[model samples]
Target: MLIQKSGHIIVNNSTNIYEEGSIFIYWEGFIYGFNQQSGKKTIREFFKNLQIHGFCSAISKLHGSFVLVLANEEKQEILVASDASGQMPIYKNQDMISSSLIELTERTDLNKEDLSLDKAVEFVLTGFQFGPKVLFDAIEQIPPSKIVSVKKRNFFLINRDKEDDPFLRTVKHDSISEYLNQWEILANAIRKEKVSIDLTGGTDSRILVAILNHLGCSFETAISGQPTHPDVIISSEIAKHLNSHEHFTSIHKVDEDTLISDLYEIAKNSKGINDFVGMHRLFQLHKERAKRGISLALGGGAGELYKDAKQWRCALLSCNSKNRLVDKLVNTGFVGWGMGSQTPDQLFQTEIREKSANYKKDTKKFLKDIFPEYHKCDVFRLADEIFYKYIIAAPRGFSPLMFPHYSPLLDAAFVHYGINLPKHLRFGHQFYREIIAVLDTKQEIASLPTTRLGMTLLPKRIIPEVLTSVFLNLQKRKTTISLNDPNLYSLLRKRLKRSNILKELVGIGLLNPKIAIDNIPNKNLGRLVSLWLFLRILDKRKN
Candidate 1:
């Protein structure tokens, strides 16, 4: 933890924590080049580099799922930053900095009742809160590409040196070849160590498999799901095609009682940032792998940077003004993610609804503050960037805390490349397909059907993309795992009945207590449950 006291900065040392003359460094998750090195060694080298080249210059060359904190006694300040993709999250309060949101709550006066109603509405409508602000007004996330400097109990933003900042580096829109070349550097670097790949029935993981196979990297594949599930079947096919050993962990085997308990624990740890429904399986899978002497695993997180345009298709392209664009961005994410259209109106009180009218207006200013080029970027690119940082980065970054994980695609080099690529190529996932086609030299992997895409990659057609989007939109409506299951529903209702936080929200006109927990709409149940669980945890800490 980094704290300010008596007008001085203090840093506590522990594992993965490094200290030098006047600099104390602590980091989580592994960087690409430092994967084989101990955390101490990585920090030692970072400190040395900092001494030679300074802060921003030292971090510019580093990449992967990491969050770094440097407490400089000489400078009397603490510096915090995350990886290029912001895969690891760190939060800041008034005078303290910590990676765990729940920990921050305990260390500060922030309670469940201090929650931001606008952010609450946003979280219920979209799966995650938008912008830097979290559920509480006092805690805010540090942006991915910028540094947060703490001095005399105050926070200041420090921009990275633009010339070396990968996200800011300009490349031609058609620089796909260059992009792949840069991607291969990180890919090959990661491949040097024996790592397990989280193969799934999705475009992202499949792309990883194709690239690794093309490069002749020896690695195993793992999937978590029932044998009958599409992900299991498709991932099995990909593994068989590559002649790679595959591991399957059935989600059905988890004990119901234990799963429910784990759900609350996950909610507490993630502080409601992650939807805990399917997360347990991944957590269990990694735990089992750790027991088998496997720690490092590669995930296909942040892959949407290459192909996410649904928001643009539905609303962004037609947006006429800044406010219109903000409304479309927020609404599209809310509706596109399968949170019901009625949630905003049904989940909150009348006063909140009136106040939420300014959410879009506020979000416009927020985006402009964090992303200076917000007004200049095309709608498609802007939407992708917003969704990447705000919606997906938190949960994806939090996954590593459960186990050691890295996403080769989430590397800074790829982020720069993908963000700069023309939006036309990404509109219908043309860029993703093109990369898969180029990498799947034997053509076998492309023939396998993707569980989400509902088709093989060989016959790339617009019809499949359209049909897939429609199918996903329909599936999002039924995302009520806890509510639909009799056992889980019973457990959820019992816990929610005991929730003082839920009652308080109702008292404050943020939640409608008249609506029974069991009767909450299917589309809104998972998010509501997550919020309830998070608040209940905070209430526990407060008491």
Candidate 2:
């Protein structure tokens, strides 16, 4: 890994880069090639293919969550591309490009004056910035599946001749089997590698078990959560059934001081975009996985593309106006995570409140222009994009950076097959259930209950098990550590009292510091603390 601290670059062995002659390739994340090729060779061939065929033709040949930077000294040209899944984020400006947003902004001397009021509003409301927008005005995210050509010295963007993208070629299939068949092929490629699966009680990870079992591939399973949590319990049951080696990491309770320390650590390390709270679990999980001598870990990221398309479908009905619809779409799962007790009028000073009025309008224009169509397919496409942007690409998706992580379900060609499936087949969970049934031939895996629905996928077995599970679970006390608890709120309030970042935001019209810290709703305390921590980091960088 390459660490940039106080404006100096530090190199480490974990940095995944290959250099031969004047050509250079830097990448992080897995590429599951069918023949189990080396990363160096695969990336080299990809660039060679790009030089011959074009961006679309070259990119479609590669699959996995990755960010690739290819520099050619001979041509004085560099190309940057992110995975189609958008799990890896690439931030850039005219002069600098970096995988880390904080590093980019710091190097470019971006400060409070560079902040975008609209994005600030969005961040406060939804706990994330959507599409290509980040917190800084000068820095923008390179959207997924895009190839940007830059000149060597200045890194000025160059226009490329339009090439036919074989990857985006839409093939309307007559049967669902076509999609399933492609899914298996992608799964088969990953099975050849020594794989570690993050098994959960959720349908997504469970589906992975069924598919890998069908492939007759051996894999170790791991789960992170409370010992009594459904995720840990259910994953254990499935692993026991398969007689697979399983690892469990308990999410133990922490002291208030430790919680505060972790939040600050996440804020400093998250590169200035993600909400730092609620990420400790995954951070601990990945930290442990790194020590297990695992070569590569398979995650259930982007599983929503098949298992639950309805989350996106429901956003369309959220409101009548275009901007409202877009807001609903981008902020679906994140709505209540923000300052719910305060409206824009109460939350911001006059200038920022006025600027925030155009937030919905401007955001709708920006994101809709990115995923333009208003049809069912377009809705799902935008939702999937947003998922990658806010969830996968955010600090929450830090699994890849922690350990060798990849999700074959997010394979380029297979996702193309999934999103292109008929609306009826993709919307409900039935499409995924059918795939699970086909893969779990003996019905042993599919018959197991999922953490999401707390019941089996099999119709006949669902009702009875759901009733019993609900009754039994209702009697148990919840053991998971919640950051939203009163102690956290009290600690954060004390910290905010000593910090001027909130006052600075209020002075700049981004927040209303006059609102008593006590008046802030408990649900929103984490968001406030997260924002304050990020602002503190920025303030230090400015110094």
- In terms of lDDT, model 2 sits at 0.62
Runs in model 1 lying further than 4 Å from the true structure: 5-13, 33-45, 152-154, 163-167, 173-177, 188-194, 216-218, 253-256, 268-272, 312-327, 334-338, 349-375, 393-397, 459-509
- Model 2: weakest 10-residue lDDT segment is 1-10
Model 1: lDDT of residue 398: 42
In model 1, where is the ten-residue run with the lowest total lDDT?
477-486
Task: Give the Å shift of residue 90 in candidate 1.
Answer: 2.0
Task: Kindly report the root-mean-square deviation of model 1 from the true structure over all alpha carbons.
Answer: 4.3
Give model 2's clash tally: 2
| Candidate 1 residue-wise lDDT, 1-543, digit = tens | 444533343333367677778877777777644332535555666677788899898887677677787788888887888776676777777777776777777777776668788777776665665557788888888777678887776778898777544445766565557766665656555654556889888888988877777767767788766666677777888887875555554454555556557777667546236556545566666666667666478888777677654555543455545446656665544322544433456556767876555554565567667767767766666666666655565443244655557876667667677777776666666777787778776778877777654656663664676587668777773223231233454555565667564576677567766666767653355566666667667777778
List model 2 lDDT by residue over 1-543, tens digit each: 222221222222345677778776777677644333536657667767767886556665666767676667787677776666566677777666777777787778877777787777777665766667688778888766467666534444433223212134556663557765665555556554566788888777887777776667767888766666777778888886674555564564445557677776666656456666556566666666667766678877667666444445544465434445567754444322342323445666666776555554565566666554544445445565545444444433445545557776665555665556666555435666677767666777777777654667663454466466557667763445442333545766776677674676676657776787677654445565676677667778778
